[model samples]
Target: MSDPRHSVLLNTGSRMPLLGLGTGQLRGLENLMPAVDAALAAGYHQFDTAAVYRNEVELGQALRELLPKHGLERADIFITSKLAPRDQGPMAPAACQRSLDQLGLEYIDLFLVHEPGTEGLRVEDPQNSVNRAQSWTALEEFLSRGKFRAIGVSNYIVRHLEELFASCKVPPAVLQVEFHPRLAQTELRALCAQRSVCFEAYSPLGTGALLSDPVVLEVAKGCGRTAAQVLLRWAVQQGIPVIPKSSNPSRVRENAQLFDFELSQEDMDRLTGLDCGQRFDPEDPSLVA
Candidate 1:
């Protein structure tokens, strides 16, 4: 038998592959396609992208070029895109269609609200939550129309999910967040799980922090893997689907070869102890409001 495909249950009651290629900071369009090429060859069938990444066009081109080489159809792959901040409200439906046009796809496997709330919304602004809830209602409509097979939110805190759940007809199918040992997000993760919502971790390798940690290095030495692999495997073993972004070809391949071994209970405990909830993302309270 071949290697087992690791999967996570989506809130749509579907099983999505646990690992995905994240296209966050792919700077230029030219450089983006090659990384996308490498990741596809490495068996990454799921892809995570957002409009803010500004590389959806490049990502679309790569998919068109590569999937044919592997004899895979569009449905063979799972593709995700997010709704941008400016694209909120009744206009979001049209924006989702535009994203589909950019990707050259009929339907997105998943669509997300890029953040909990839009930027420039201040504290105690009752309209802030109301606006986000309204945007989510639009997303829910898209889900109904089958434009997005699944709908979710990224960078949402527990409070944000709670309010959305209270106001919207559809709860988020997934929550994509910046989670790592340093920023454990245990409570938020648990809350999503309780609602049968899939949780995805963005920046799971601690955004290069794992590369320099002495403790992580020691663990990697013992495990005979690189610090990056150690950190990724830790997240996978914890049952969180992690998308670690890497433009380097070698690192892209290395990130995918993580299903072979299980971390020991002791090592898992040690990894958990490393959490200081250190967040790499700059504080944007607008996101949590």
Candidate 2:
């Protein structure tokens, strides 16, 4: 990761690195510091975390110490966090403030509603819709107070986005969802483009489960790249921002080396043909909590 070769302009008038590190299931200084330190060493300025990640304090401290070591500052790193499912509705603002407190930052670069569904309420419940609308209003308050630069949603489909748009005064600036060559999310990407929302891909490599896919391997070999690079590049080339989490420094560096290579029409098409609406981690309402 040395000077990430590309950046995407966010709807909030900010430039976000197309390739960043995702901090999930990474908790405590023991687990987070090394990755954060290595990511910074490898030149990763963008990071994605969440309230439910239980590692915000660690992420915050790592950045606080590591940024200066890299000759960088808070302004140099773009951090994104999300609202937990348990914090939906009017409780959203409190959750936002809590995340701010956990990160020990004056302002957050980006904030997102973790899901259209929640922990306390059944995902299929009609109340989820009401909670979503009220949550958007609460998020707006957080934005107005300068707690965050931009606000968006995660795990949201077109219908969910439509609902958010219908009730929200400030539409979402970014939509974070699982995406990879095999899970292209074409219609959702189109929806975001149509609405001027920057679409972001999480698990761009399908949570490390798609790295060994036949198509990915073939494309990587033909391009003289790693499967991870091929997969991340696929999303970037399509104008979707991607965050691929890895604890290995080599893999982290490899993930950001996409700008140096270009995927030819043939390779691109082959990879595109791999899409079958498959997802390694499907959004299960039963597991929302």
Candidate 3:
């Protein structure tokens, strides 16, 4: 517990950084490059991306160009990307190759199936359990080929994982999901721990919606930290990884400032009690235009 920069151990025994940067929702070289520059300067060593983000090329270029300036190398950083849903079944490995070409990396540190099911590519047609098993087969094939060090899934629930584990040869090493004080995901957390799968929290700040929460703010004030830091600290303290996205340099720097302090047990309980199963997704009115 003393090491604030501790890495979460995956089933593969590879160390995944507990705190990372999310590159979704911020496309184009203009934003991705500078935000990454700021994140690098802020001491971030991990980055999350996806094929759907449409910034793999730009992100790869930016990191390649910027790393030299900071005297860093690929080994110093951990990169995570995802396979899109449309590329389920036989298309999964091809998509990973395309992503490798886009990122220009020798091998990805971690790669995940972005979604459990596909739209229409498979005969099963958006079949959750079967598609996941099929896509996992592709991932496992490429994984042995040295395309990705560890493979996992995003947006997958308990049942999908159980089914995948039953029929697949490789077990998922990580699970990424939308998490915050509002959506505690306690059962998912328990299941992940039980299976030794490292849980990674996306939108840990609630995509800017949880920063102003009264409960979060109250806990932050007592800890003398910002709401974002409190939330990130809470997630990592629970032995989960968190990726918080921000383009503002100051805010980007501020987002990873969770290592300085520890949240009290009482404050953790208060934050835990704040969970009422609230979630923010694309369907949320506040997110729509």
Candidate 4:
């Protein structure tokens, strides 16, 4: 990894940067390369993308060129990609391989199901119904073959996890979710802790709300840090690995400069109190129908 100081060693014994660069919103071939290049230049070694993002080929090009030019190799970075909703079921493995081809990587550090059995677009159910159990079975085969170093699911609820536990043979190593001060996800956090699933929080800045919060701004002023820095620190202190997306060069560096400060118990409690179940990307159960 380029930035050793900002790394968070995961339970799988892999050292991933606590602050990952998210490319979910990054679009267009032109926008993708420069953003990725900016992130890499800022010393970010973890990149999060998905097949559905449709920028994998461009991202792959950026990585393949940028790393070698900077004297960095593939292993020097941790890359995560996901299997899309349509690519589930018996075709999941081949679909994963396709993603690998697009990423131009031999092994992915983490592979996740983009969403749960929503819309009946699972591998096991052809009737367009949510059949997570069947999809998970396909995930198991990928895990068993070491195609992915670690495997998990994204956007899963408590019920989804419960269902997974009831059916899966191997427990998930990580669970990626939309987490921030606004959407603290207390219940899911506690459940993951109980189950030994490392929770990785995406959009830890509340999709920019926390960055503009009055309370966060106040704290940032007092602490001599940006609101984004304060928010990132809050999540890191909670031991939740966070990936904050940014294409701006300065902002990318600012996001990674969060390890120096530690939030106090009082500060943590104060931040925790900001939670009101304000999920930026709240899942609708009816979508599963």
Candidate 5:
């Protein structure tokens, strides 16, 4: 069993591991299997993937092969997949089903809308709002049907979340975004806190750009941890779940060694002070209507 301190209770009464293995850019059984093996051995109980990542099939295969070897079952782990932007609105149901098919899962622990805007639609288009509402409605139906244990959205900003709140019957259980020391996302985090939405983080290492940062390096040195550990620690220490992706087996194991050490208040403050609202992901949800 994973440490209780490493997991948080979602609004849907599900326990989500704060330190998950991100499957973005990790494709093929050859690449994903070892990472999955390392993750499982390192006590990771959560795996996050998306349709856009185009590796759900391989991830499913890897898990099926690796979980038994690790003495684990489907119920012991949490899996998350997403509806692609191309499949928003009327196509959401099919997309959700396809993700389940690709992942080879009877039910995903979480399913998130991968982006705020639909494909081929302008950010300011009114249809985006309608499509988002319809998509959420479809997800709500799936939740009722037990296709998804919890539903959420990714890369959504304040306006996007507010619009969803006004119309959604079941509020989101999680809101995943690119969060790190450089991109603290204070306002969005506060809104999610107020709404009881679990604010989760992806790219917590700033998409590999923050590893060499002087402040991060200094903090890592002070804590005798790797830069990746320091950055991931900054988020999970705040009770924010994080999925920091890496295909290297050693790095995967190394990344999971976050629960042993504690950062001082001064170190935490110094890291938080690095927030300049810098976002590493190219897709800016703020541009979406």
Candidate 6:
């Protein structure tokens, strides 16, 4: 069983593991299986993926083959996937179904609107808001039908979330965005806390840039943990869930060892002090209307 201390209770009354394997650049069953095996052995019970990643089929296959080996069931693991921006609005229902079909699962644990805007449209297009509402409505319908146990959004700014709050029938259970020591996302985090939304972190390492930072290295050395672990811990220490992507088995195992140690308050403060609103992801949601 996953340690309860290492997981958080979501609004849906389900516990999501704090440390999850991110299957973003990891494609192919051969490549993904080992990483899944490593993660399971390391006590990770959640996996994050998206249709845009194009690895859902592989991830599903890996889990099916590896879960039994780890003596786990489908319900023991949390699977999070997203609806691609291109599949926004009217295409969302079919898109949600497609993810379920690809994953060979009856229902998804958590499903997110991948971005704030629609594909092939200008960022400031008014239709982006219209399509987002339509997509969210479709997701709500799926949630009602039990196709998705929980629903949320990704890369959404404060405005997008406020608008969603005003119009959505079901509030988002989680808000995932690019967050790390360099990009703290203070406003979004505060909003999520105020609304009881689980604020999740993607690109927690600043997409690998923070790994080489002198401050991160000093803290890692002080704590006898790795730079990756320090970065992930900084988030989970504050009740945030982090999905750090890595295909290497050793790194996957390394990333999962976060709960074994804790960072000092000073270390945490230094890390948070590194925040300068630097975003590694080039796709800025603020640009979307």
TM-score (C-alpha, index-matched) for candidate 6? 0.99
- In model 4, the Cα lDDT at residue 102 comes to 91
Cα lDDT for residue 151, candidate 4: 81
Model 2 earns a TM-score of: 0.95
Between candidates 4 and 5, the lDDT winner: 5
Better of 2 and 6 by TM-score: 6
Q: Return the TM-score for each candidate structure.
A: 0.94, 0.95, 0.93, 0.90, 0.99, 0.99
Tens-digit lDDT track of model 2 for 1-289: 2243477777787778887899988887887778888888777778999999998999999899888888988888889999998998878878989999999999998999998886777666888888888888888888998888899999988788877788788989999998877888888989999988999999888888888898889889988999988988888898778888877667777777878788998898998898988877766532332
Error of 6 at 27 (Å): 0.9
Give the per-residue lDDT of model 6 (tens digit) for 1-289.
3678989988888888898999998999888999999999989999999999999999999999999999999989999999999999889889999999999999999999999999999998999999999999999999999999999999999999999999999999999999999899989989999999999999999989999999999999998889999999999999999999998999999898887788999999999999999999989999999
Query: Scored by Cα lDDT, where does model 1 land?
Result: 0.81
The TM-score obtained by model 1 is 0.94
In candidate 2, how many clashes are counted?
0
Q: Which stretches of candidate 6 lie over 4 Å from their true place?
A: none
In angstroms, the error of model 4 at 250 is 1.9
* Residue range 204-265, candidate 1, lDDT tens digits: 88779778888788888888988888888998887788888888878899998888887788
lDDT assessment of candidate 5: 0.94
Candidate 1, which segments miss by more than 4 Å at Cα?
A: 1-4, 285-287
lDDT of 5 by residue, 39-97 (tens): 99999999999999999999999999999999999998999999999999999999999
> What's the CA RMSD of model 4 in angstroms?
2.8
What does each candidate score in C-alpha RMSD?
A: 2.0, 2.3, 3.8, 2.8, 0.8, 0.8
TM-score of 4: 0.90
Tens-place lDDT digits, model 4, residues 1-289: 6455566555566666677889987877677777777777767788999988898888888888788766788888888898887776666778888888998877888888878754445434434333456667777777678778888888878877887788789878788999887788888989998988888999899888787788888788878989998898998887777889876767877887877888777777778889897878756432442
Go through the candidates in order and give the clash count of each.
0, 0, 0, 5, 0, 0
Clashing pairs in 1: none
- lDDT, candidate 3, 126-204, per-residue tens: 3545666778998898899988899998887777777777887888899998888888988888998998999899999
